[model samples]
Target: MKLWGGRFLSKESKLMEDFNSSLSFDKKLYYEDIIGSIAHVKMLAKCNILTNEESKTIVNGLNSIMSDIKEGKLKIEGDYEDIHSFMEINLIKTVGEVGKKLHTARSRNDQVAVDMRLYSKYKALDVIDNLDIILGTIKILGNENAVIMPGYTHMQRAQVVTFKQHIMAYYSMLSRDKKRLTSAIEIMDENPLGCCALAGTTYDTDREFTTKELEFKKPVDNFMDGVSDRDYLLELLSAFSIIMMHFSRLSEELILWSTKEFNFIEISDEFSTGSSIMPQKRNPDAAELIRGKTGRVYGDLMSLLTTMKGIPLAYNKDMQEDKEPFFDAVDTVLKCIKIMNEMLGTLKIKKDNMHNAVKRGFLNATEAADYLVNKGMAFRDAHSVIGNIVITCEKKNKAIEELNLDELKSFSDLFEEDVYEFIDYENTISRGIKKEM
Candidate 1:
């Protein structure tokens, strides 16, 4: 069953076989491996490396194996070195001697390169699809919850903003994330099937035919780089890390808003969990878990970066370390995206609580400054007058809007009846900066 057995006189020790085996994790790549092999065998026949009949038999065998694997009729297991070895062994078992010809003009080096590229492309699209769902949910939230809320700076209420504007901020962040994933997919579109080991093969293999069969943009230009390039994986992991980071920020806000202290929003019971000891606890476990998993995705990215940083040109055993990290990141990000969409879609907004919260904070002090500036006070002088008014209001335990016109005029004769309109919570949002679509 071993492809390289002809060169070795003795069987590899059981311990060494166990140490070298990757069938456990890499078997997940069976579908991609079969796809690339089908294309490779067809190209082999076109190049006259295999008879047409032999190519047909091998392709049929591969297709049967793929269907069996999908249907759970066949199981991929045992001491196979990798997915490539496991597949070649199974193909030989199915098609007899003709299956040996399937690997005649290729190597595991290029085979894995093509499989990973295909897998990454599929997962990137999955990420983008989930992002579309999240974007749609955000748009719904924005349209329904356009009421005013207090926006924060340094975790303290600093200005007035509409809920729609806050949600759209995340929409903008995720829009950029979608672009990054698309760029990563574009970078991985080339075929790496015919590079064979670290150099071009002497056999007359038709790389262009296989490239077209696999739907790659083109065959890779350099044999060594084809065997060695993993920048696409790195690029994707980087993009996934950033996507998770954005999700983590949103998760933090969700956790905060769901708290009794904030009471700004209420997560649906399905997405929340009760504390074991407390009768009155409904914790935001989903949001907390998404925030926690952000670090795991970050670790996956860093693990691959460190592994690839020291490896030399062309394929190396170190590159075998690439798959687990990449797979973990993809799975983690996709799950987080889906759960976040569900959590957000079902959550309830507390518009009254948000409005009352706005009243307590001196969120209108800036508008008061603008009121003074409109009365012909210098900008810096207006700022100072507002600051002094805020201090006096705090001493009397009142908001700037609570001060009467004669009391506000003690600081400056510029105070007017229209000053109340300038600091009104609803008016502040209407007068503040607006974002262009």
Candidate 2:
């Protein structure tokens, strides 16, 4: 029988039961549900709603159920409507009539609210921990590969940069992602356990007590908002999407770097795959998959955003649609971060190839223009002189630096032996341009 089936004389069809049941996915919240219930029962006993002995019995039964589930002794199966019902049915069987009192002043509405908040809180922290690992890996790579490389804009080589600077640029982006995730965790720290359905309960319940017990910062201010709010979930999904965006950008570079045409870096065999027919094929499948998974995470955020946009105040069944998307995004981002860290940590940097590529791209053209400007040439005239010099170099099949000093002086009297220093790749990086910019 359904927990709230007291008024209905007819039984629910199997189709309705299957359609309405959330135990399939919500079983994942078994630990969270039990933790929230234990806190609530403790608060009830503190308020004199349940006798001390009755509360003890309920708490012990809940703990036993938790232990059994953790030990793989209790299988979360059968036709219970949701996790709350599954726990309640088992609690009753474990402790008899006293177990029923555990739900005296609460509803599944507030119960689910607290469970989800707890789940989000912990998962957000877990994501931050993984991000810290990624950040550390990036810092190590940045320090190790501080050699000069060509930086590009619009897929055309535009300037010279240190690989260290390039790697740390991603580090800055992930630093912001960490801050955003931490803020999301703070936003979800309120307890919703004592709010009951959509309003304050008539019982003399101590919400503050439950908040303290459950380690939430405070109880939510409004009961209706407490029951209906999914902003925390949305905020978390937004964070996840942004993090994936950063990952996708890095993955794009990794893909390009691993290609033979670029040959900037070599992915390790452990993180790469081989083609069946192509004897020389070694693919950066990990990076490619991380890039691909980014779209699915974005879709998850959009799915939840669209679901919540039209819902009314207070809890509704539509809110049930929020879980799968949030869960999938969280799982996807965590896995991506783990794999990305491994791929980055194991990859080989071809320092000579990177420096050689920088030489081929005329990345020092801007510095040549700057050199003329420093010699009292007007900035526009300096740019024009460098443009003509580049055309001449291309005609001769020579680099600007490869030109004789007399040939350079022919372009402008401002050219001097120091022009060679100005075009040096390492000197370009040492010119005080900020890495993050």
Candidate 3:
């Protein structure tokens, strides 16, 4: 029988089972679920809600179940309504009548709330650690590639920038994401377990003891508000969604960089795949997947935002819909963090092609203009003179430096022999590249 079946008269349809069964996805929170229950039982004994012997029986049975689960000896019974039901049902089976008293002061309403908060707390920290690994790899690459390449704008060489500068830009964004996760965790640190079924319970429960036992920072002030607040989960997914967007942009560049047209970087073969039809193709499969998965994480945030918009006060069954999105988002971001770190660690950058690109795009023309200005010409006149020089050089089918001083002098009397020295592509690039370091 289901845990709530004692009050119901008939079995739920198979359609209902398939629609409402969270056992499949939520089973992943088994560890967090058990931990919360153990804390709850301890609080029950401390508050005199359970006799000392009863508490001992319940706690011992839970400990055994935890061990069995760790050893993979216990099957997660699927017929129960959820993880709470499954644990309670298992507790009764293990320790007999006294095991049923484990749920004395709390309802599943508060139980699930605490479970989600605990799970999110643990999951968020795991993501933060992985983020540190990703940032470390980027820092290493940034330092190594500091003098390797210059920056670009509008797909044209605008200025020289080290590859290190580009990597550090991403590092700054990830630092912001880490700060966001830290803030969200602090907001969710309160315990909601003693809230029971929305209103404060009448039992002589010790909210302080449960909060301390669960490692929560404090008890929530309002019972109804505590069970209904999903803001913490929303904040976490929002932060994750933003990070996914950053990864997507990075993935797009990685895709372009690996192509024959760019030939700027070569992703490791292990993280890539060969095209079935093209014998010569080794595609960036993992980067492309990170780009593709961005939509799913974004959808998770949007789904929850819409769900919370129309809800009334206190808890509702609609809150059950919250888990799938939050769980999917956490899993998606965690995997991306791992794959991105590994890919960046092994990826190879081609310094030669990056440098070659600098020479083709008239990247140093602005330096030519500035050279005229430094020679006592007004910047407006210098700008016009540079335009004419470019047109003259283009007509002769030559680079800017290929023009003779007499030809340059025709555009402006200020053209001097020393102006040639300031006009090299490397000079312009060096000035532009200095900002990144």
Candidate 4:
């Protein structure tokens, strides 16, 4: 039986039941729903809204259902409106009349709100758990690999930076993502259990008591907004999209690096795939899939944004649209983090290829120009001198290191043997804050 519909004479149509049903997806919230109910039941008995005997019976019943579900003795199947109905019906079966008392001071509106928040809380931490793994793996990669590579802008070699400097850029990004995920939990930690039907109940419900029982930081001050708003889910979806974007960027670089033309890194055989016919095709399919799935997570955020836009306040069925997208984003982002961590773990950095590329790209031309400025050349003149040397080198198909000291002096009288030391890629990369490396 549904938790409501005492006045309606007509039964819900079969097709309508199918359309309105959320048991397919919201069944995932069963654990959260039951946990929320247990807290609510304890508060009801304390307030005398439910007798002590009634509350004890209901709590025992709810725990039994939770235990059965956990041990696979119960299946959450059958036609049910949502997890709340699935819970109430089975609850009534387990505890008889006392189970019916479980809904006394609460409505499914607050019931569902608390369920979503509780689920989001734990699931967000699960995302963080995977992020910690990725961060640790990235730290190990940066420390273990001590190769210098070309840093780029507009896909052209711009300056000299180390492999550590490059990968740790993502370390910085994911650290911020971890912080964002953590903060989103705090913003969502207010308890919504007492906000019955939006306006709240006339019953002397102790919201604060339930708040403490549920381990929420505080009770939501406005019952209407408590049941109405879904800003927490949107914030997490936004954060998840940003995280996918970061991984996609790194995936793009890795895919390029694995190519024969770039030849800068080798993806492990485990993370790569071969073509159907061609024997020589070890495609970077794992990274490509990660890159491609980024759009899927982006779509999850956008779908919820659209669903929530123009939605009326005080809870609408449109709010049901939040769960699938939220569920999808958490799953996608966690999987992406796992796959990306593994992909990065198995990569082989081609030190020779990176160092050779760094040599030819005039990546150290800034140091070349800086050497002139140290020798008292005007800053603009120093920049101009380096630009001329690059063009001359390009025309001759020769690296700056290939130029004799006299040829370099032709550009600037400041040119000396020591200029070579300044332009060396190793020295160029040492524009360092020591502890970070």
Candidate with best lDDT: 2
Each model's lDDT: 0.91, 0.92, 0.85, 0.91
Residue ranges of candidate 2 with Cα displaced over 4 Å: 433-437
Lowest lDDT 10-residue stretch of candidate 1: 428-437
- Predict model 4's lDDT versus the native: 0.91
Worst 10 residues of 4 by lDDT: 428-437
Q: After superposition, how far is residue 127 of candidate 1 from its true place, in Å?
A: 0.5
| Collision pairs in model 2 | none
What are the per-residue Cα lDDT tens digits for candidate 3 across 153-180? 8766665556776778899999999999
TM-scores, in order shown?
A: 0.97, 0.98, 0.92, 0.98
Candidate 3 backbone collisions, by pair: 149-161, 150-160, 150-161, 151-161
What tens-digit string does per-residue lDDT give for candidate 2 at 328-358?
9999999999999999999899999998988
Per-residue lDDT for 1-437 in model 1, tens only?
68888989999998988888888988889999999999998888888888899999999999999999999998898768998988888889998987888888799999999999999999999999999999999999989998788899999889888888899899999999999999888878999998999987999888889889988889899999999979999999999999999999999998998888999899999899998899899989999999999999999999999998988887998898999999999999999999999999998999988878888779888888988888899989999998998889889999998999899999999998999987898877876644344
What digit string (tens of lDDT, one per residue) describes model 4 on residues 196-313? 9889899988988988888899999899999989999999999999999999999999999999999999999999999999999999999999999999999998999899889787
CA displacement after TM-score superposition, residue 361 of candidate 3 (Å): 0.8
Itemize residue pairs with steric clashes in candidate 1. none
Off by over 4 Å in 1: 433-437
Which window of 10 residues has the lowest lDDT sum in candidate 3? 428-437
CA deviation > 4 Å runs, candidate 3: 148-150, 369-384, 397-407, 414-437
